[model samples]
Target: METSHPGTGDLATRATEILRELTGRSDAAFRDGQFEAIEALVKDRKRVLVVQRTGWGKSAVYFVAARLIREGFGGGAGPTLIISPLLALMRDQVAAAERAGVHAATINSANATEWDEVLGALRDGNLDVLLISPERLTNPRFSEQVLHPLLTGGVGMIVVDEAHCISDWGHDFRPDYRRIGALLASLSGDLPVLATTATANSRVVDDVAAQLGSDTTVIRGPLSRDSLRLGVAPTSSPGHRIGWLVQHLGDFSGSGIIYCLTVSAAEDTTRALKDAGWDVAAYTGRTDAEDRARLEQALKDNALKALVATSALGMGFDKPDLGFVVHLGAPSSAVAYYQQVGRAGRATDSADVLLLPGTEDAEIWEYFATASMPEEADARAVLAALADSPAPLSVPALEPLVGIKRTKLTLLLKTLQVDGAVDRAGTGFVATGAGWAYDAARYAAVAEAREREAAAMLEYEAGHVCRMRFLAEALDDPTAHDCGRCDVCAGQWWDSSVDAAAESGARKILSGIGVPVEPRGQWPGGMEKVGVALKGKIPAGERVEEGRVIARFTDLGAGQTLRGFLAESAEDAPVPKNIADWCITVLSEWDWVERPTVVVGMPSATRPVTTADLASGLARVGRMVDAGNLQLTRDPGSPEVNSAFRVKNLDGAFRATAETAAAVDGQVVLLVDTEIGSRWAMTVAGRALRLAGARAVLPFALALRG
Candidate 1:
């Protein structure tokens, strides 16, 4: 039952006062639907879902509700709990809470040392708001020790920020977010809950609302941004796109973001832009947390012209005055594209939004879109292995037995843990033997939905209909109407013209190639379990020296050429003369500790001619003795399996020829291959050569797959 508090009639006045204090503006007032949401939570004690556009003051409603409830507006409720998705979002919310005098604290991975302090504050009832990542809900310690007690004791309010992630129908579905449903179920009936997101379509809306409750009050506002001028510019190639950005990034006003499809693309674009005198930086998952914070601050302070980043910088970045957002390639779905572009024109009168569609966008999308779903066979293997284990099996220990990559394995385990089929013990993951059933139907439906979204994205790029209207309809926005500001409606506001000089410079930069191939410093986990007799740091004597590759398979430069050569349908042929020349150039430019006196080829079951030609060409040009191919005692087939299985498969597969061993005795040896997929081949072959008395092995490959 809803509880009535004193001065319920004055909630609007009090909320407005709090809003003014939070905004530091005397005239601050609630926008349309904002006061209604605040009143629903504070006075009516009702659950609410607010699907307002970004910069529409969604945070204001929750912050005001928390303050009112703490001040006995909701009959003396407990402190509010917020399940935020990102550390960045938590930091912003905590700061905003402080400004509003809400006394907020956070528990997340980045601030582990402060967790105790935050917990103390929570116990003391000194915090009005507590923000945490959704992943924390699944942590054994956090759930049993903290969350359970908080739920039992009573929370005044629960907020799921970026609530779209809670639904599989959402564009950015995170597995950890599935735990929110359980958290909601544990709460008392009278407690208020709020779920907020800007990107959810009608399907996602229904899914999230069902998770919230049957009585959830959803308030969805217009999805269109009036200040955004959208446009799509089709590029002929990756180089042309880079050239376009170099030429026209300055044309947009103020600081902005240039989105790339992959981390390699982000780095390449950053380098090319910097070389052409653009002040920019690359942001991706590979960036360290400290560096990420620093770069984010730089962008906020307008210290950089733009941050060329992948999806790592997509959500929860609050830059109200961000002037523009440009996509180097289209995202797989209009929902995702709209969310990214929403960051712009938020607190500005106008911001330019441009999409430079690339020729390889679909290929990149296919690579990432299907990576998260767990295969039935892999899931069953994990369950059977765990069921047979005497104790919890860590991911490494299970890797060899299951034959799944570590990254994919971890994701699968998390899914199972959430499904109640697995539990995390001190040692590792233990099977609960709960008779877990694979939801093949659900997974298949999700996959089909993704394909449909991909097709819709292609249609959006084609621009047959109004871009804004297309996106609005895809989002199931009821107020779908053509915005007169986009390129289609406004007759091409963006110039598709390219600068010749910039194009030439970009082509030259892309052509200049050499990617460092860092040697594997340690054997993958579970190699010992696979009977490989290896664990921990690789012996220095058996390790290959730092090496170089012609380019990454994801590179914008020679990547297309390399991809065609390595295509499954392409016949195995000798290494092309241009690639051979590039290989020679890479060797000449190498700053090695010692010059290689002999070159050895890695035996390839599929591309023996290409591998042999590369080794012989390098040996001839570098004037090094040709050590010939390392004899394959037993073919490992292809290095397409996980690390543990790959190492196991390659064990005792190669032996250095007697002549090759003698030729390389006490001398540096160069190891050449047409391509490096898992790098296991080079590592195993290098170990063989090192054991055969080669002083050192330097690995070189035509291309490195990211």
Candidate 2:
């Protein structure tokens, strides 16, 4: 791929030609100065990073530049390596390009044989562009065995899409992105790299530049989209806001997405909407890849009218006809909200981005903030489990040791590997088996890092400054145009009395003397209208005596007191912290928060519990009783060991005796206890009990007997 006077004529001519072909507009037609700079850079062969928004012709910029490199230089001499973030995205790009007459192929970890073929094609100068992910490139084998050789021969350009991933400050940061700078240097004989992203503020630009080892040519277009109408709704529960969604959906013509924080919430909403006779589907991280494929196809084909999903559902998914995007859960930052809502209004016609504010959004983010990391003991347990297993253990298998969410667990494992605590082999991770030694100092370092990140997140969430300004500052862009599209921008929607009532309720519960509750968004009567007012404030006339409880404020005894229907009826205990966290969120959003509390955990209370608890709890109960009969008399401290006891074969007499003794008078109700699975089982049981009888039946014990 050799050319003469590379800085002048040939590169410019070819870039113009490609641009004309793609947009049916000549390079001269572009009034934006980007093309001139791009033309100059292609001739000088400098690394470039272009920052723009979605629907802006950013991809067209690279597509044209790549062709210039190909045509100006000799044929079959060098190839362009485009490091994309995802396989689906890579495939989509390749297919889209192929449709437009560009020869491109994907090389990812999942397709080694195809990767080998692609590498061979590149070596033979048959490939014009090769798309791969950063993860694949980081594999030493891919770098040493493939990239090093290709670049040494002669490679023209290296392009990184979604360049924001390189920034640690980005909302979606990938650890592998840290190596992209070094990767680009390796791929093109240290050739000039051009990075492109749909979203990047000044902070991301610096990070992308530093990551690419070049000063980025940041071409930031306006973030504003006049065609998109941004609206914020103050609702108590996401469920209640469905009416808003229904109203909008009825008014709108194109497809829509309702983003929930949890998989179950997505499913529940999908079901509820379906019951109401809406053509909708649900998507989450757990949705099988095949299902996602079908869903995407359905979306493209207009077979599905709407989709209820978590954040995982729509990445790299392109749907130009999308008209509405609903936030079933509150997002932690404005940037995230922007990205999700930006999915709609892809074309020219106006689109609707609806935010249904619920109390749980803050709490969900806090859960991630306070999520426990694997301690030294936990690491040891995890290592032991992995060491004992002949095969690699799935994350679920190690749940007993690392009690955390799957996403956090994955990141933790990655951190451990990077820190040399474990070695990854193929898809499964193998314990290094270096030694049984646990280093307190090393553990402290990791803990400190976790705490620092958590603190940063907390600050970002609770900041009183402009959301757009905060995002801009984080992105390293010191200057940012004020985006008047946020909760703070909209004035208080609640009434003064409601705000005062909310504050009084919160002060009644959480305040000591004069300290007021801090609210999330602007609320009337100061902090009174803020959802945090729901935390400590009790509603007037709300009282509890025995089983019949009076409800004034919904926040009191949130996770502790069980509400009973009648005096003789058994009361189900209060919603758990996780569930209450979701419910209070609902109340706060609706101005029903007599007392609002800052979100400390979980995203929303509307998220339903799972079924796996029934299996585990039933098993534990059966084992304990079986062991008690077998004389395995062990202390209660021993979780694995059970104690055996002997009793007279009396039933009614046994009950009378048990009732007469003060110590034994406690009812042996099958409470799920404060377990993750317990909440789910209780949720299921509570629902089942409502449909069945008033008799207190031991749900799990019966299953164990069965």
Candidate 3:
């Protein structure tokens, strides 16, 4: 005998009940368009695109729909597969699923040990939902070993969280998300697919919808967050911005985020805030995974005042009562600004959103905007090298062959892999033997679109128009209207005045410079391939001791002055009195084991005067012997390159002068330079000094560039 199923109306009613249970609110009904999206997925079995504001309950739609489908609402469908962008997002969704009585598991980079168990649960039909990062979809191990079997078994529905990332035109375009289109194509026609994003303009929406299917249903709600009060706090300098944050951060009611554009900026701000007695932590891409988890928890629990962070903290960090979101520098695009600010006022009646635009923001934006684009020459070089290799080539192995930097090379490989031109095999990358064509037109279009978005961001900072409405229009929100709570709409709500004492304190911190210059412990891999005998770790006796620099090339204080002085157009000249004084201050603060008895200068083809003057000034101040400059065996023209290539280029580039070698024997030497780029010059020169009988060498530079 066949069993009868419940009616469509009954299933819809059950979804409401599930929502209430999940939210723990008896009156938790689906928001205006939420039920419609759920119904489309559960009953109609159609692909859906949901463009809603944050805190508008998009996750609820998918979780409830997954439960309804698994309960036989759509022919007793299999488990739902959610493609999440961030690990934090996945954790929150998994917890939400459990509260709704849905068995959920996640396979991500953070939980390698749990992957097998998660896969087993999925294979046994013991899970109602499975979440995985978008990047995991492209991993060969997962694609061939796990994903194939899961797809064969059939997934009831697929959800793409932060769907804007799928579109190249989106502000946060991620190459990994391109795999989602292929995944969608491989699924059955009737498999319900849902893509959700809080930030998407019409262009991104059309792009994502086309990726989903031509007949996909898009349900876009108003982008306005009435609870958010937007404002821009324009400051004359970075110090002023820091002062304002120091003075006003505590006035906010709850924990929040302070977003910075660069990792260094985030670290500097965190340190300054902490020194001022604020409980804060720095969160960036370089933060360890374990630390990231702990910091995320601290922020969620309100243990810290704010997480001074980069974009790494964006996307899917849930804090229901987050009091504010402040940007130390403006994002390059209004779409990104909206997405980050959306993190606030979610589950609260009101929250503050402020922008503190910096002068260097544009420079930083320009660097990042063009860094990830696939250059035709670089792509062709990568492909040619891979084709020549009989076996898979590791990144280190391919670095010298392609002559492209590691970071850019990795991004290029990922783009090619997603385009079916490459594959990852075991420990290395192999060409797929598939014919690939470079999409030059597409990349050019993306570049142009980015330029436009950057311009839009500048306009946003101008604050000439209603801030909320401007963002809404940028996202193509049809209901764009003046959000009366914004500074432009109703006047500024935040105090822009900086405290005098705070400004003085911040100026002191920014001006007092000396960043540690950690020596490279190991030689770059694959140096043997380049005819260099060096490999593995550097010998301790020959290695340069921990050094110091005046500041990073991107620093806010003396860095600005150094950048101006060291510009390509600037003439080589003696060190300025102020910079020389600062150098002396740094040396005085140094806690070296041995005081330098001599100062030796590194040979600089471009800035010889600057280097020689720096050496003489330091020697005079410390009353040490002024050793002559190291002679350059060969002039390696300044070439923009990575570590392996840099090391290869600088081989035999410098030699210790006879006078310097004899004078520095059995004495501590300070190796000084105008600026350090790649640090290969210092490494090579320091080794020469050590080989010449110097007891120890401490590398010093005005600026350090990685």
Candidate 4:
């Protein structure tokens, strides 16, 4: 039988009976000390806070204690309320409670207008527990509609889920958390409080307690994920790091996420992965709502094997069975890293977090600093602009006058709001009495904080110590021990010991007062691929007609080399080595440059080559273009060609399949048959078109009116 320690003897017996009836296995995980803590809280009717990581079953701490309170000291039953940060979690908790034979109702944004039904359940004692979101709690109707009824009738316990949100000092500070304490103060004074979170440090614990406005009792367990093996790789280029990621992805099972620094990077990486034969999807703010929905569904169905996305992918929605979470760039803060990594390994499985650090990440940080830190003059100008406007100036309008980027201005506005200098009005800003006085000290402090975070990235990338230890320390868990599972403890299993030590040394170098030393050989490939392609090589071959040499372009002197045959011109004319030189000379002098691309058969030419053979025969087209091997120029001699080709699906008609629809974008094409008449035609840019119904134009534009 399950051993249960309730506040009173009668309640203890009832809880024991209840546990026996529910799970049939009743070993009391909570013993003498735990029982005493709850009994004292019940006796004094004091608030309690529980701090535990995921998989520790933190929910049990409150529910068990609340059940005991209800049985031992209650006129009938008092409702235990839970304020969850996520609406999905609220629903999940309610379902779990219902399965355990406890009645729980959830009131959140989804059904905010109909929350009275949820309150009706709470007031009539039909529910043992009621769950709501912080947003819902702040609703004007909540106090008038629910709190008054519950407080006057009776209340057993109050729980704050994802309690770390209350920590304004932490990286993931939610502004509404500041109001939670004030809201709690207005609730029934005698109601006991409980807070729970999967991830928490000492600072977060204090924040949670302070936000509750109660004498919070913290119950912590060991912070250990024995299964996860953490690793960090140092790279200088985002592209090279992505190549490394491609090499490692084949080893893991389940889905994965590759985080990019920008929306363009995310899309480019997704495309590269797809071209490399991996099924990939991308999610960014720029993605249309419809595409995001489709991609999200595709991820859940495993139709898309991986997702390359920005930070927007984290919110509580996606719960894929992720095998790994790879950071293509350094996260803005340790809190962001923890939250992103926490998405994996949620269930009884294990997942690894791979960090690829490069100069790009550092450069990105520098860019963020440069972009976000406005000049003192600009800040003053922003204040002046706001002062002049009667109504709050929209964010876009203030950008040109203030000389700061919109995002940075938003950050500044938020900071000013935090400091009581401004208030947000709709999509604009309104100045409070607090003005933007020049404070060098404040500027220094802000800059130093950002620099410290950048230095932490350097430390994480370069440290030879256990990565999990580095992560724990970065997250403010100073007492964290070596997990015996991370790369360092495993003897640099996923990374090079030499590289790791080099990074650590680099960090030390930066720590010194003088100009930081740029350690030679720190970056691979020495420099970015620029001016010339180091691997560029063009093969030489002799042209022949009917097994005899037709023309010899060999020994064409310095700077003039035979790259490839452009055409077999009806048994005449010398092939031009430089198309641009030929075009410039001909088009400028004769007003025409015509170069044909053709192949001669074996009998007709010394060597016969098919188009198929020549397609990849060109050694790196991009490199050739870069090296001026293949040149382009405007041919003024011939008017710019204007023509359109219509792709048909075997019926000699404009109708196309989905595959054909996706392929024909940006190409000049004709639309006919079931669509608009041929007279209303256009040469559209194919890439911008979207598919609707069975067909879409090659280049999308406003429909032609016939």
Q: Which candidate comes out best when scored by lDDT? A: 3
Over the stretch 203-230, how does candidate 4's per-residue lDDT look in tens digits?
6677677766656666665554555667
| Clash list (residue pairs), candidate 1 | none
Model 2 spans with C-alpha error above 4 angstroms: 1-10, 23-37, 74-77, 109-120, 138-153, 185-190, 243-248, 369-405, 418-421, 431-706
lDDT of 1 at 522: 71
lDDT per residue, candidate 3, 1-706, as tens digits? 1222546458768889889989999988888899999988988899999999888899999999998888778775689989998877887899999998889988876565466678888888888999989988889889877778778877888999999999999999989999899889877778899999999999999999999998899999998888899999774577889988898898787999999998778877886798799999888875544457678999999999999999998888898889899999999999999999999988899998889999888888887877778888998899999899999898767877877756678888989999999998866889988999989899999999999999999899888889998999998888888888888989978777788999888877676798766575667655776677877788987789988888876776788788778765579999998888889889998889999999999888779999988999899989999988988888765444445556777878878878888998999999999887656678878988888999999999998653
Worst 10 residues of 2 by lDDT: 642-651
What order do you get sorting by lDDT, best first?
Answer: 3, 1, 4, 2
Reference-based lDDT, residue 62, model 4: 55
- Residue 514: error of model 2 in Å? 47
Clash number for model 2? 28
- Can you list the residue pairs that collide in candidate 3? none
Model 3: residue 314 alpha-carbon error in angstroms: 1.4
Give the root-mean-square deviation of each candidate in angstroms.
Answer: 9.5, 16.6, 9.6, 18.3
Tell me how candidate 1 scores on lDDT: 0.84
Span of 10 residues, lowest total lDDT, candidate 1: 1-10
Q: Score each candidate by Cα lDDT.
A: 0.84, 0.50, 0.85, 0.51
Candidate 1 per-residue lDDT over residues 1-706, each given as its tens digit? 1334556558788888889888999999889999999888877888899998888999999998998888889685688999988766776788888777799988876555456778888888887898988888888999876787777776889999999999988999988999998778766766899999999998999999999988999998998888889999875687899988898888999999999888778877887898789999888865534456778889999999999998888778899999999999999999999999999999899999999999999887886766688888999999999999998888767877897756678889989988989988864888887878889899999989999999999999889988889988988888988889898898888777888888888876667887666577777654655567888788999999878888877666587688767755568888887777787787787879999999999887778878888788788888999989999898685443446667778878989877988998899999988877667789988999999999999999988765
lDDT of 2 at 633: 23
TM-scores for all predictions: 0.75, 0.60, 0.75, 0.57
Report lDDT (Cα) of residue 61, candidate 4: 52
